[model samples]
Target chain A: MSDHQPSQKELPEAPSTAPTPAGISRRGFLKGAGITAAGTALLEGVQGFSREAVASTPKGVKEFGPEPFPVTLHINGKEHALQIEPRTTLADALRIQLNMTGTKVSCDRGVCSSCTVLLDRMPVNSCMTLAIDAVGHHVTTIEGISTDEQMHPLQAAFVRHDAMQCGFCTPGMVMSCVSLLEKNPHPTEADVRYAVSGNLCRCGTYPKVFAATLDAASQLARKA
Target chain B: MNSFTLADCSTVEAALSQLKDGAIVKAGGVDLLDRMKNGTDTPTRLVNIRNISTLRGIHSTPQGLTIGALTTLAEVADDPTIRTQYTLLADACGHAATPHIRNMATLGGNLLQQLQCWYYRSAEFQCLRKGKELCFAFSGLNQYHAIMDYGGCPSVAPSSGAVALLALDASVELTSAAKGKRIVTIRDFYLQPDANPHRFHVMAADELLTAIHIPKPAPGTRSAYQKYGEKESHDWAIADAGILLEMDSNLCRRAVVAMGAASPVVRRSHEAEAALTGKPITHETARAAGQASMTGAMPLSMNAYKVQLFPVAIYRTILLAAGQMDRDPSAAG
Candidate 1:
C-alpha cells in the first residue's frame, strides 16, 4: 500500500513485545500512537502520512484498529464477560452484550436519563460511561431492581400511578427514582423533580412520574 | 464513536505517566464521551484516572476547604460543610446538569468542560474555537451565545463551578511531572477567548488538577447563586450570578459578584462589588449593583435578553446572599 493512501487497512500483525525501528515495542507503539494521533487530530485535522512516516511519527506511537478486547463487567450481583471495542458504552454492553435491555439509551449523549443505572448504587448515565471503566463497579439496571417474583416498590408504584405513557422512559425514571429514594427516603416534590430532571418523557408524564415517586417514597418510609 | 484503547491507570503517578505519553485522561466520562461521539474530540487512548484515590474527597481545615479534583459533583452538592459553609458552590453544583450527571461528573471535569455553543458542539461548523477562521455563532443562530464581548469566539464559558469559584476566590492546585505543583487562582485559570480561542483554561495537557482550595471566609459571610433558565430543571442558564458577601450588621464589608453565561469567561464585576461595599444592602443599593454589574456589556443581536436577565440574576443573588430574599430565586422571577 502507498504510504500516503488513506485506505482502511488492517493493523499489521507483529509480536506484541517486538520493538520497531523506534526503541519502543509494537504494543507500546500502538498504545501511544493511537492516543497521540487522535488527540492531535482532534485539534488539528487528521493528516495523511505514509506507513513509515506513521510508524516513525513518534518514538512510542502506532495507530489502532477497531478490534474487540475482553472486558468483565459486574452487573448487579453477577459478572459477565464480553468482547467489545473501546467505543462500546456500558449501556450497550448491558443491553446488547448481556441482554439486559431494561436500561434504555435515549439521547445517548448523557442529556436524557433514559439510560440511567446505578453504578455502585449512585445513579449515572450508562450510555455516557464506558464499559471498560465499569469493570469493578457494581451496576444495577431496572431488571435487577425487581426480581422475577416481586417488583420493587418504585416499580409497583410506577405501575399503580400510571407514571408512564409510551413507557419508553420508564426504566430510566425508575432507576433514578429508586436511587433517590435510597439516599433520601422522604424526598419532597421539589427533590423528586430535581432527582429526575435529566429524564425527559415526550408523553408529558411529569405529574404522574412525580406522583409515583412520592407515593413510593412514602410507602418505603412506612415500611421502615 | 471512534475506536480507542483504554489505559486503566491505577495511581496518580500512573495516570500522569500516561498523560505524559500523550494519553487523554477520563474521569467521569460524561463530557468526554459525548464529545468523542459527536466527533468534536477523538481521543484514541483514555487514561482512566477515576481510580486515583488521593483525588477523591472533600477535606476541611482550619485554613479553608480543600476539595479533591476527582470528587463527584453529587458529593460536592451533598457534603454538609460545602452545603453550609459554601452554599454558593453547593447550589451551583446542584443546579448544574442532572442527578445522573452529577453522580458521574467530577469537579475537575466540570471545570474543564468545553463551551456548550450548539455551533461549537456540532462537527459541521468549523468555528474559530475549532481552528476555523470565523465563528458561525457570530452571524448564525446566536440566541444562546455570550452577551459580553470578549472578542474572537463568542461562546460563553459553561462552568457553574468556575462562576462559584470566582465568587469564592478559590484557587486550583495543578500538578505535573515537569512543574511539580503550583496554585492558580480561579481568575487566572481561565483565559479570554481573544487570547486563546481554542483553549478554554490555562491547564496544560500534562498537568492534572489535583484539588481546589477555597479559603475560609470571614465571620458572617453569606453566599448564594441564582440562575435564570427557560425551564425550572435541566436547562443551561441564560444568565446566572454567584455572590459572596461579608456582612457587618446591615452594611457589606466585602463583596465578590461573579456572572456566568453572560460572558465568555466567568467575570467578577468589580464595579458591582464596589457599589455594595461599605453600604447597606437595601433595595436601592442592590438595584444599583445589579445595573452596575452589566457595565460595558455589549450583547449580540439575539442575546440582548441576557443583558436584561443579568441584572435580575445579580439582584436576586445579592438579595439572597444578604438574607433579604427568603424564597428560591427561581420563584422570585
Candidate 2:
C-alpha cells in the first residue's frame, strides 16, 4: 500500500449535518463518523471518544492529554512524532495521525483482531492500547511486515493460496501468521489455526488461512 | 472512552503515589480499555503501571510461588514450573481469550475484569450491577446468564484466572499508598452480590493488586481445568471447572473444586469437595461429585441448559484431574 493520505475527494461523501468540533478537520470528522463505502468501519470508529477536555487532575503526576500532547511513536521501524490526545489509541494514531492506514480498525474494541499489531514482536490488539503506552516499544503494522521491494514470505504464501475472500481480514491475518512464523518457523495446521484464531474473517476463509500459514512455514524453513 | 491524563510511572512507589480517587491503574490496559470504551468506567486519569519492572515476574520461595500482577497471561500460561505443578492455572490461562490477548492481558487485569453480561457491558442498559434498579437479564435474553448463587444479578463471573486461583488456594497482595498492604485469599478476594452489587471485588479505588501468592501444592496433588464455551476460540467459558486433588495412590485425600461462569463469583463447591474427599477415583464417584455440585443451583428462564452443563463440566473435569479419563471429545470448547 502507498504511504499517502487519501484526499478529501477520494473519501466517500456522506455529508453530515452534525456539527464538527473545532481542531478536528472535516476529513477527520467524516472519517471519525465512520462512513465507509465497503461497510468496513461499521461498528466503531477509531476515534470514537469525545475530544473535548472535561476535567484535569493535579500537575505533579506527569500527566499528558485532555489536550494534545507530544507523543513520539516508533512504528514499522521508524520514529514518527505527532501531537495526539492521550485517549487516542494506537490504531487511531496509526490510521488518522500518521496515515499508516494499512492497519485497519474494523472493530475498534479489543474483541476483533482487525487492529492487530506487533508491540515488541508480540501480537496485540492496537485498538486497546493507548498511543502513549506504545512509547519505548517497537510497534509493527501490516505495512511494516515486508520490505518495500518484496512481500513477506507469509504474504506471498497468502497470495499463492488465495487466503482471503472479502480481503478485510487479510492484513491482520498476515500479521498474525507473520508473528507465528517468527516464533515457530514450522507450525502445524492446528498451530496455524490457533495463531489466527483471534483474527475473524466474516467470509470464513479459515481453511485457506491455515494452508497459507503452513505453506509459509515450509517456505521459510527451506530458505533457512 | 473519555479523554484522561496518562501518568506513566516507572516504579511501584510512583504508581502507588499517583493513585487517587477516579484514577485507574492500568497494567495491560486490555480490560480497562474495554470498560472505558463501553462506557462502563470513566477514569479521569490512567496510572500506567506497566513500566514497573519489579511488578512483572514470577519468583519461587521456600514456601510457595509469587507471581507479579503485571505478568502477562501468556507468560503465566507458558511458564514451565506452572505447567508442571500448577497445571490448573496454566490450563485456564492458556485457554483464555486468544494468543494475541494472552500476550497483552495481564494476570491482574483478568482477575479484576468485570462481569460479561450484555446489559452491564452495553452503555444503553442501566442494570443493577451498575448501581441501577433493575437487572434486564431477569426478563431479557439470558441464555448465557448465571444458573447458581445469583442474587439480584444473574451476571456470571468472567475470569478463568480467578477460578483456577481459587482452586489453587492462591492469595492476592493488595497495596495502597495509605493502607500499605494486605493479603487475602482468592476466595475472599471477590465481593458477593449480596455484599455489594455495585462492586465486584473489595479492592478500594486507591489500591493496586501487587502480586499473587500460590502456596506449593501438597505432594501427590493432581490438577486440571476444563472450560466449555459456545465457541472453541476467543470466547469466555460458558461453564468452567478447575479441580485440584491430593491423592494417595487411588484414594482422594483432599479436593478443591472451584467453578466459573456458573455463579456470580467463582465459588468452591464444598458439597462436591466433601463427596470426593474420601472416595476412590472412578467414573461413578466423579458423577456423584458432579451431582453434589448442583445441589441448590436455581437456573434462570433461558439458562436451564447450564444446569445440565455444570454437572457434566464438574464430572469430566474431576476425571481429567484424577487421570481417570481423557478430555471429553465433544467438549473441546
Candidate 3:
C-alpha cells in the first residue's frame, strides 16, 4: 500500500499499554501522536500524576471482550435474550437484533435525538447507550408507547396536527414528549418546547410538534 | 466502534481493578461513546462503572453537599436544594445540551469531557489536541475557538458545569486502587493546553473521579450562570459566565467570577472578581467587572465577536447574581 501519510517514526509515542490492533484506524494513528505529546507535556509538572497512572499494575480483574457477549435486556416490559458484541449500542439491539425499526438512527453520534428512547422512563439517546447498560433498566420505544392498538395521546395529536413532514424525527420527538407528559401532565408551551429541544426536525415541524404536545396534554388532562 | 468486552462493575474497587489492562471507565458513556464512534479511543475492555450504586446520589452534609461522581446532570439540575442554594450550578446543568443528554451525562463526565474543537473531533484533521503537530483552528474556521489563554491549541473548554463549580469553589475527589483518594479544587482539576494539550483534566486514565465536594455558601451569598450561544438552545456556549457574590444588602462583600468557552480551560477572572468585591453591584461596577474579565483576551481571526459577547455575558451574569437583572443577558446579546 502506497501511503501518503507521514511515516510511523515521525508520529508521537502511543500510550504505553494501549494495544495497537493490526488495522490502525485514523484516530489510532493520531492518538499515538497525542500520547507522545502528553508524555513530554507531563514530564515537567504532571510527571507524578501521569507516570503513576500509566504504570499501574494490572490485577486479576474480571474482563469481558473484543468479541460477543450474552446479554439480557428488558425492552417494553419483555425480556430479550441475545448474543451481542460488547460494542453494540442499545439502538442497534432494538432495531437490528430484535427488528423493532420504529426507532430511527439519524445521528449515530448522539447529536440529534432521532434515536431517543426511555430508559427507566428517563429520556436517553439509544445510540449513545450500550446494550449491556440497559440490562436492568426498562427500555421503552415508540412502538411500546401505544396501548392495546389505541394510539398514545401524543401520537394521536401528532397525526391530528400534521406534526410530521417526512416523519424521520417523529419517534424521538414523540418519545421525548411522552416522558415530559408522563411527569408533567399539564406542560405549558415553553415546557413542550424545552422537552423536545433535543430533537432535530430538519423538516421544520417544530411549531406543529409543540401544538401536538400541548394538545395531547389537554387530552390527557380531560381523561384524568 | 472497535469491539470491547463490557464488565459491569458493582463496586468502585472492582471498577478500579478493571481500569488496567487497556480498559477504560464508562460513566454516562456520553463522551466515551463519541470517542469510540470516532475511533479515537478503542479500549479492549470497558469498566462499566454505571452499575456501582454506591457511586450515585447527592448527600447533604452540615459542611456542604457531597455529590457522587455518577450523579447525572438531570439529578443535580432537579435537586431542590441545588436549585434553591446553588442556582448557578442548577442553571448550568439544566441548560446544558438538552433534556436527553442531561439525563445521561454525569457531572463528573461533563467536567472531564474532551474539547469540542471541530479539528480535534474530526479524524480527518490531526489537531494538536489529538497529538498532531499543529492546531488547524489557528488557520481554519475558528469562530467557536478560544480567545483567552488558548496556549498552543485554540480549543475552548466545553463544560458549563466546570464554569459553575469554579465560581462555587467546589473540589473533586479522584480515587484509584493504587493511590487511594485525593481531593483537588475544581480550579486545579483542569489543565491548561500548554501543560498537556492531549489531556483536558488531571484525572489520570487509571483514576476515577468519585465525588464533588461543595462547601455550604456563607449567608447572603447568591450566584447565577448565563450561557450565550448563537442558537438559543441545544448549542455550546459562545460565551458563558458564572458569578458568585457574597452580598450585604446592596454591597458586594466578596465575588468569584468564572468564564467558560473563552479559554482552553474554564478560567476564574481574578481581575473581574476583584472589581466586584467590596463594591455595590450597579451598572457601572458590573460594566467595569465585565471589562476586567477580558483584560488579556486575544481573539482569533473569526472569533473577535466573542471578545465583545463575553463582556456583555459577564456584565449581565454579575447583575443577575445580584438580583438586579431580570431578563437573560444572553437574550439581549
Candidate 4:
C-alpha cells in the first residue's frame, strides 16, 4: 500500500494566541522532546539560567537547570526531603541520599528491573524514574516491603525455596512477586512467569523464583 | 543523563505551553529515560505531563473506543471492552515488551517511541536518524533492521499498538496550544525517513497527542495479532502481523492486513487485503493472501530471514483471526 502523507498545506491555521511554530526548528524541537536523539551537549547551555530568570519566564514557559534543588520524595509511607539534581533517578536518590541501598542498579536502564519498585502500587523501573517525577506518588522499594524488620511473606518464601544464587536479582524479584500476589493471590504458573518476566536473574533461578512466588501466594491465602 | 529541569504540568493546556523551547513531554519515561541515559537525547527541560487528568482514561464514545494518551499498555490489554471488541490490540499489548514495561509505557508514548536500533541508540555512531549523513546499519550489524525499505533509515517502528491500531483503522486526536485540535488517521500519521529523516510522525513539536479513537468495526469482524521475535520475552518483534476480517456467512466481506517490524512503518498490505476480500477464507486462500502481502518487500542484507518469516507471521495471524487455528505460544520463532 502506498504511504499516505498528510498534506501540510491542508492543515488548519493556528490561532493567534497559540504558540506559533515560527522560530523552533525541527531538530531543536525534537532534541528536547519525547524519545528523540540523545546528546548531553545539546542541552549544556541550559545550566546557566538563574532562578530569577525562571521567575520572570512566562507562565507556560519552561526553565532549564542542572543545579541541585530541594525536593520531597514520599517513599514507603514516609516523606524525605533532600537536595538533588533534576536528573537524579529514584534509584539513585534511595541509594545515595536516604541510604536505602536495597534497590539495586545493575543496568541503570529500564531494561533490567533490578531497581524495580512500586510507584503508586504499579511495578516500575526505579532506575528510569526521575526522583522529581515520583514526588506525588507512593514509592515502595525492596527495603520498604517489610514491616518492623520482619521479612515479607514473599521474601520468606524466597529463602524457603532457595530462590537466590548470587542474590543480585532477589530484591527486584521479590518486589515484583509481591505486586503479583497482591493483585492475584491464586495465580497460575504461567501468571507467575509473566509477572516477573521483566526481572532478569542471571543466576538462572527462575524455577525457584516461580516456586517461591507460588508458595508465598499459598501462605498469604492461609493467613487470610 | 544530562541535567535538565523537570517542569510539572497539571493540565493539557499547561503541558502544551511548556512543550516549547526545547522542552520534551515525558510520561512513563520508559523510552525517554533510556535514551537520556544512552546520551542520545538531551532536552533542556522535561515537561512532566503525567498529572494531566484528562489524558489518563479509557472510555467508549459514540464513534467508537476513545483511549486517553496516558493510558498504559497494561490497562489497554486488561480492559474488558477492548479485549472483547478489539482483540487484536489486546493481543498486541499483551505480547509487547514485558509486564513491568506494559505497566509503565503509555499508549501515546508507545506510538511515538523511538526505534530500538543499536547504532541509533549508541553514541559511537552518528547515524542518519541522528541527522548525520550516513546510516550505519547499512554497513554494520542490521540483523534487526527493517526488511521493507520505505525510506533511507532502516530502523522499524517498534510499536505493537501501532500495528494493531492500523488493522483496527484507528485515528489519533492531536491537540496543540497553536493548532487547537485535529484528528488524523493512524495511516497518515507516520512519515518515512526518506521523506523526513528527523521526525517519525506528522505531529508538530507543540502538538500533544490527546487520545486515540478506533472506529467500531463492522459486525461479525474478528481480529488477531501475531509477533515473531527471537526471544519469548522482553524482545522487540523481528516481524509481526495483524489481521482484521469481517466475515459474511463464512465468506470474507472485508479484510485489513497490517505488518510491522518488517517495515519502517506499520504498513497495510492492500494486496493481501484484496486477495482475501469477497473470498472464502480457507487454508490455501489464507496462505495465498500471506504470499501476496510480500509484494514489494526489499530486505536488507542481514535481515533476509524476515522474507521467510513475514509471510508465516501474516498467515498465522489470519488463521487466528478467522478462528481457523489456535494461538501457538511458540509462533514468535
Candidate 2 residue lDDT tens string, A50-130: 434335433334656556777677777677777777778899888776667678788777666988999999999999888
Q: Estimate each model's TM-score.
A: 0.87, 0.90, 0.87, 0.89
Predictions' DockQ, in order: 0.25, 0.39, 0.27, 0.29
lDDT of each: 0.81, 0.84, 0.84, 0.83
- Cα lDDT tens digits for candidate 4, B1-333: 876777777788888877778878899898999889898898868888877888999999887899999999999999999998899999998888878888888999999899889998888889888888899887788998887765788898889999999989899999998769999999999988898898889999889999999999889999999888887778899988899999998999999999888778889989999989999888888898889988888887788888888888888889999999998677541
lDDT of 4 at B332: 46
Best by TM-score: 2
Residue B109 error, candidate 4, Å: 0.5
Cα lDDT tens digits, model 2, B173-247, are 999989899999998989889888888898888789999999999999999998998877788988888999999
User: Which candidate, 1 or 4, has the higher lDDT?
Assistant: 4
Best-first order by lDDT? 2, 3, 4, 1
Report the C-alpha lDDT of model 4 over A1-224, residue by residue, as the tens digit: 22232232322222324333686655335434532232243245344554554666556444435676777777776677777777888887887656576788898877769889999988988888888778778898887787554889999999999999999988998988899988899999988998888888888999999999999999899999
> How would the docking of model 3 be graded?
acceptable
| Candidate 3 per-residue C-alpha lDDT over B1-333 given as tens digits, one digit per residue, 9 for 90 to 100 | 765556667888878877667778889999999988887776756788887888899999998999999999999999999998999999899888878999999998999888888778877877777787788988899999999898898888899999999988899999998899999998898888889777777888889999999999989999999899977667789899999999998889999999888998889999998998889999899999999989898999999998898889989988888888874834411
- Itemize residue pairs with steric clashes in candidate 4: A37-B40, A37-B41, A38-B39, A38-B40, A38-B41
Name the best candidate (by DockQ): 2
Q: Write the per-residue lDDT of candidate 1 for residues A124-196, one digit (tens) a residue.
A: 8899988877877888888778765688999899999989999989999999889889988999998898788
Better of 1 and 3 by TM-score: 3
DockQ of candidate 3 relative to the true structure: 0.27
